[model samples]
Target: MRLKNCLFIGCLSLMSLPALAETVNNLFQVREPVSGQTPDEKTRATQAALETLVTRLTGDAKAAQGATLAEVRKDPQQIISQYGYDAGPPESLQVDFDPASTERALRQAGLALWGSNRPVIMAWWLNDATDGANLVGDGQSSAEPLRRAAQHRGLPLRLPLADLGEQSIGNAKTLDGTDVAPLKQASERYGPDAILAVHAQENGSQWQGKWHLWLGDKMEQGSASGASAAELADAVLLSVSQRLAPRFVVKPGASSSMALEVQGMTLERYAQLVRLLEPFGGRLRSVNGDRVVFDVSGSVDQLRSQLSLARLQEVPAGEVGAAPVDAGQTPAVEAKPGSTNVSLPAGTADQTLHLRW
Candidate 1:
């Protein structure tokens, strides 16, 4: 009798196991992590972008979005704290330097390297322990001016190592501000073939450098400052260029000649896209009209494809109050006389190859 009772109990337990397992599976569904993603790098980029969005949405020009500058910064800050941000942690990477020497070397290095590549952003000596924007008290030079100088050389410059506050201010902490862990959450934000995160510092007179290249979270390749600063910067840039340098950044709906894909879209949007793409030659893999696959061909414009799109400044601004451009045009970022910065739409195949750091 006892044996029979024990067998009955065991059978019942076994019968219920499958149902329980199914229930658990639904509750704990696991998604493959973003195929090519990085939380830290993404967070930083997005944090920067979010700041930009705020300004574009609110600033003097007033973006189409109805948000005001203060509100623009505030709302995003709230979400950032929830998403691409976190409260202060106890670690730090603060190092001591001549400040002047470090800034000069970095600024010059940045100028010489990015001169022809991307547009200039603001530069200034870091002041507050936030966003690395400290402007040197003396105010002689900072990342901002050099960053601006780089832009003058013809890339669409954003703000530089210094005076980033003037670029697009947001609420970001410094000291422990790297926010690397958070940025790891959204790695694609940089929009580069290879996102280059480089660090240069004085290790008792000799500069030390480190770089990381990633296609999302997976670190592709990297090098430390074994070589000179120029060598280090050049090597990193070249590596990134090599990794992301495709003749064409193709997509599914891009063209027969391109390699890319599209997720879900509408017919009207597709038709509109077709109109926009009349200039390019590409292959369509499959077209439901509403959904399309394409193969875009050729290498993208090397400079534009890899780095952030920056427009040229015809007449550089000498001071803060001076409007960077003449009246009618609204001082657009992409319409510079000698430069261009276009925001083209995406391709199909849903395929993307990017750089994450």
Candidate 2:
């Protein structure tokens, strides 16, 4: 089989946080084919798009049936910011909603908001062909269906390069094996936030597959069957979203205030940090040098979990609240003999955190 390292240009551009953020900001957008730009057609399309956007943002397919959805339908224009037509033989209409208004509706509805800054999953897909089994790589035709499913679910998926270096780590044997260490090693180059291993086979008109996903130190595996490749891909996306929803979903409730010390604080870094935290309903209560206190709607544990997923490194407990340092400066301190610095446990209250960017 021919293995290539090329990735989709569009996919590669999403690697940066800024780019990812921009994409997430537009998560509420939807495009649908239309026969003509008639008033009735536009209205119907807008409503459909709004429903899709609500479901996509909440990760709950039934979110559209809720009270907030009713409010949106009552005055759809309240949430819709702009929309236009795309040139096509079968004309298509694109709708864009106001993010702030949509989010407020979600919060008022007491539903969780699955923000767009999601974890990037590196997927290793293997398919059984007539001649033999083939590994799916970047831009492979066979993988297009899976990519569309990922887009539908708003999940970002990257395929392996399957280069000589990757093959040396493991091949189909290691991928199909019970051990996942080799696959993890092979995935390091992509800097994935998580790893997914999927093996699919076609039986007549139906498709079946088993998949394994590793997020941080946790691992989950499942099997699915579908009537079509698209159906199978949607099933896979649903399973993956189930695993991710708990960690990323923002449920509504009373707000909580937490104190945190952030090392390496600068004017620019502080602004960036606020933007990152704003999605979680974080508001700055106070900022004294590197230490910050935030009034956030979510619990401290939830906040920590989200930050970790965002790639922020947790400063060792001893380092928390250590005097603020200027940009590009490191703190110099000698550890005491026979004294060990213990890192705070997960869910610890008011622990200090640091951003790696």
Candidate 3:
């Protein structure tokens, strides 16, 4: 079960928090092509699907084969909720893993899991075919492969409309250029948190792409080649997932418990805050006026990444009116009626963190 589920079960009514980043739905759902419907084939396909899911969630291509997940690989159905075969040009198996069970299992295995709240990626892809070079637009047929790739890798990808002005800016020079001013200017209208630029060319029947990803102050660039466009797209998205996961994934044993204070809390904001802090094992420490304190466990970067989703501002440690409050030093106050019990950790002044909602 998710840590939030443990803390809030039957305690407070839960509602979806307004997320700053796009929440990629169906992260646990995976589909892998199969050659036949035989029992052995289905079993093998199921294992392959589980491997794909583990890779997608942890951003480690070999996670499913790791010693930590050996038992899970032996009994793949332990966390699966449902499965069915999709009759396609290439037959495929669609597996839906129970999210809670899967999460619990992964945590128990000591693997770092990436949350569903992922950044929205705007992709500007320029394709060079034998006939000519063109940009892949939002409504174009060529964009379908990229969408499938994004979904398979659990990325929220968006394509521009490819209007005349955008096409002018989405050229080879702009895609390959180190300077992102032109691309960022064009991407502002799309409102994506990250920008992806790809220049793919088809030589004979093989496809290869040079890609660049820009997020915050970080920029990553790489090249990928595949037998076809679909394969190339999948390779590129997998690389992107690998790059993005480390920024958010909270590995086991890497977290330190600390006191966190969030000011400007109301009933509604409280609900939102709870959901946002779920991954950090956020436990209510106390409530004073609109300010609320929590005992949370995670790295500073991970906490900052999650709280940024709610537009929370971090108050410096020694601010005049915003000094960090040690939860242990604060007098104990009874939790509101029907609230679940959260054990407050023993903390000192230096172990406290503060934020403003």
lDDT of each: 0.29, 0.63, 0.80
Error of 3 at 120 (Å): 1.7
Looking at model 1, report the run of 10 residues with the lowest lDDT sum: 20-29
Give the alpha carbon lDDT tens digit for every residue of 1-357 in model 2. 100111111112222324222234357777666878999999888877777677678777678778656877777888888999988534678888888988887777788787776778888877764566777777678677777667757788888766666645435566556678888878877877788887777888888888888877678889888987667877888688767767766566643544444544444444444545655554334434444444345666556656665556677656544644222222211111112222222122333334443
Question: Where does the lowest 10-residue lDDT sum fall in candidate 3?
Answer: 329-338
- Candidate 1 stretches with Cα past 4 Å from truth are 1-180, 185-195, 204-206, 224-235, 246-261, 266-280, 283-289, 295-357
RMSD to the native, candidate 1?
25.0
Q: TM-score for all predictions?
A: 0.29, 0.70, 0.84
lDDT of model 1, residue 46: 44
Which digits, one per residue and each the tens of the lDDT, describe model 3 over residues 185-221? 9999888888999999999989999999988767999
lDDT of 1 by residue, 273-294 (tens): 2222322333333433223443
Relative to the true structure, candidate 2 reaches a TM of 0.70
- Return whichever of 1 and 2 wins on lDDT: 2
